[model samples]
Each structure stands twice: as C-alpha cells, then as structure tokens.
Target: MNRTARLYALVEELRAAAPRPVTVAALAARFEVSTRTVQRDLQALMAARIPVRAVPGRGGGWSIDPGMTLPPIHLTAGEASALTTALAAVDAATPYADAARSAAQKIEAAMAGPAAAAARELARRIVTLPRPGDSAIRTAVERALAEGTVLLLSYRDAAGHESDRAVEPAGLLAADGRWYLIAWCRTRRAGRGFRLDRITAAAPTGERAQPHDLAELLSGSAAAGAVRPTALGPLPVAIA
Candidate 1:
C-alpha cells in the first residue's frame, strides 16, 4: 500500500491490536517496509499528535491509547431507550443496519456504572422489526440529504408505474413501518414523498440540491405537508 493508506492502516492496526504492543519488526514486516521506515512513520504519526506510544524492552513495542479510541457519546436512560427503540423499528438487513448496530455498541461501550447496566437491561426488553427492502431508500435519501445533492431515481409508485426522475431529496421520514423520501421531483415540479419499497435505483446527480427547496424542506411547514403523519423535524444524530 501507499504511504497514506499505510499510515491509516497503521492506526487501525494499533487500535485493534491495542493493549498488546505491536513490535516494530512485526509492523515493518506486515507493511513490507524496513524497520527504519516503520520507525519514521510511527514518529510522524506521533508528531501529528496521534495518541501513539512506544513501550520499551525486549517484548515492548508500539500501542495506541485506548482512551483515544472512545467515541463521543452519552445518553440518558430515556434517550438510549428512544434511540435503540427507533432503530429496532428498522430492518436489520438494511444497508445502514450494521452501522446502527456498531453505533449502539459504541454508545454502550462509552457508558459505565449504573447507566450501562440500565441500557443493557432495557435493550434486552425492546425489539424493533424492519421491512426487508427499506434499507435502499433509507441509504439513498440519507445520502442525498446529507450531501445536498440531487438524485436520479428509478421509482415504482403505488400503481406499479415505473419511471426514472431526477429528484432533489431534501429529507426522510419513517412512519407506520415504512420509509419515505421527500424530494423536489423534477418531473412533477413539486415536492413529493416516495415510498422506500418503490425505489428500484438511486444515483447522485453531482449537482447541488436547490437552496430554497432544501430550506423549504428543512422549515418543517412545507415538508410536513409533503406526506401524511410525516414528522420531518430535525432529530438528534446520536452516534451515526
């Protein structure tokens, strides 16, 4: 791998193999570089203020600070329940499911004392069911909203009509065991909510989602009217 990739890989390796120092010779051999090069790379990482440390002696090596790897998250018992509760409502096979699971793990890992026990106990009692194909639309709509990009979508509506349209996806809502994409439909010249299951494909347009339209969606007044029982209000993004 190139230096940049190697540097990042080194960090991952240190983080994963942490508490157990990875010897310089082992790192060099793993990266297919000389000992000197590995040493310089480690120094560079340290100089850049990455939480790396070198242990001494014959068995000693390099290690990353475990505390440095902790994710920044803290949740009240109610907050934790609400989050895991919402996530449980979504399908486990969705594209973002693993991401949600990992975030949940990190959130729990960051907790300690009584809070952690409560979270773990509550998690045992709460279960959310997910629609199998809801992941596609969720991933697409979320990306479009986050990047402020237009999306080219192949959508099948309620009547089973299939059509391709370029849409500016402004926001997303999950309601009644379903997912919806709220977007400015180029074909209809209006904002519409398309069901997640109906989307066959979604591709980014590399164009900016119009500011006014995005603002209109973010304003809640316009987006709320886009779909029934739609709660398009901005919610806190916990871990993911």
Candidate 2:
C-alpha cells in the first residue's frame, strides 16, 4: 500500500475500534510497516488535524473519536469509474501522481464488491496512452513543488548543450504533448520553462524557495497565450 492509502486505512482502523486504544506495534503489524513508520504516520495524521489520540502507559495505544469522523462513502459503479478515469489521467509527469493512484485505490476499496468489479470493468473500456518521462525526475520535481524548495537539475537544451542548474519550482505546464517544469532559473536569473524530457537529473536542494509571483512570470513569456490565465488565476491568493 502507498503511504496515502495506508494513512487512510490507519484512520479507519482506529475508527472501527474507537474509544479503545490500538497499540503502535499492532498498527505496524496490521499495516506491514515498521513501528517507526507507524509513528510517523500517526504524526502526519495529527498534523492533518485528524482526531487521533496517543494514550500513554500499558494497554494504551492510538485511538480516534468516531463521532468526529465522516461516515462511510458509497459510490455507484459509474461514479467510481469516473473517479478512476480522472485519476488515471494524472501521469508520471504530474505532481501528486502517487497520491492520485492511492486515492483511486482507496475509492475502489471502499466500494461494495459488485460495484467495485463493475467500476473496474468500466474503467478497462477506456484507453489512455502511456506518458513518457523519468519517474525519478518527476519525483524530485514533485517534492520541490510540494515543499517549496530549490531544485538542482541536469538539463539538455534543444541544442543538446548540457548544463547544471538550480531553480525554484513555480509550476508545471503541459503543452504540445509535453510537460514542462516552470521555474525560476538561478543560472539565467529569470523564469524559464524546462522540458521534463530534457531533464537528465533532478534533486531537491532542501533550501526553501524565494518568493516569486508565478502568474506574473508566465504572463511575460512568449508561451503566455498558450497557457490560460485561469490556469494560474484560480490559485488561492495565499498559494500565489
């Protein structure tokens, strides 16, 4: 199970045994993960404001207040299939790709057995082409964007000239059947769009990115018209 699904399952497990603590070791065993990993997951749940409590001492463990949790979701076969189709469209080049898959799995897992089977069959009828890109580079770019950090990139331009660059990830753009990482290039001292396929290597620098207006930068670019203002305009002001 991916971490996202595991987190969701962890909540369900606690909710099912509400008011009674389930030990960390037991949770680790149930999830087939290390106790340390369970601890981290618990911390993440807490960070997300989940109503989980860590009780102390013997016979103590983790528990959630069921009253505070949402009721089970029930999706029709067609609805579930619709979700699958949408999530499947999130390719390796997109951010949160893993999370999207995890969410789809959770949705299926939540469905009634027959409904889930029908959903699967319906999803199979729709075909999609595989996206081409390096998973490692995609992961690095996703992390840089998620954490608001600087990224180190090894890039080969159209001229086949290779160079190393440190950039602040601003956003991603999909144009002309390709994905581009829109970033503030430190080397060029300006905003630039680097094609994902041309990125030979990518790594997070672990440094927080300096603040910049991504929409303003994109508006000034030659490809500005190719990108819709609504794409960057609808973003929460705090995010911008």
**CA lDDT of each prediction against the hidden true structure:** 0.73, 0.84
What tens-digit string does per-residue lDDT give for candidate 1 at 126-220?
A: 76554566555567666777789999999988888999999887666665666667788899987777777788888776799784354465355
Candidate 1 local Cα displacement, residue 55, angstroms:
21
Question: How does each model score on TM-score?
Answer: 0.56, 0.67
Q: How close to the true structure is residue 227 of candidate 1, measured as C-alpha lDDT?
A: 44
Clashes in model 2: which pairs?
A: none
Candidate 1, number of clashes: 2
For candidate 1, which ten residues in a row score worst on lDDT?
Answer: 222-231
Q: lDDT of candidate 1?
A: 0.73
Error of 2 at 147 (Å): 0.6
Assess the local accuracy of residue 9 in candidate 2 as a C-alpha lDDT between 0 and 100: 90
Candidate with the greatest lDDT versus the true structure: 2
User: Model 2, stretches more than 4 Å misplaced?
Assistant: 1-10, 13-60, 63-77, 226-240
Clashing residue pairs, candidate 1?
88-128, 91-130
In terms of TM-score, the best-performing candidate is 2
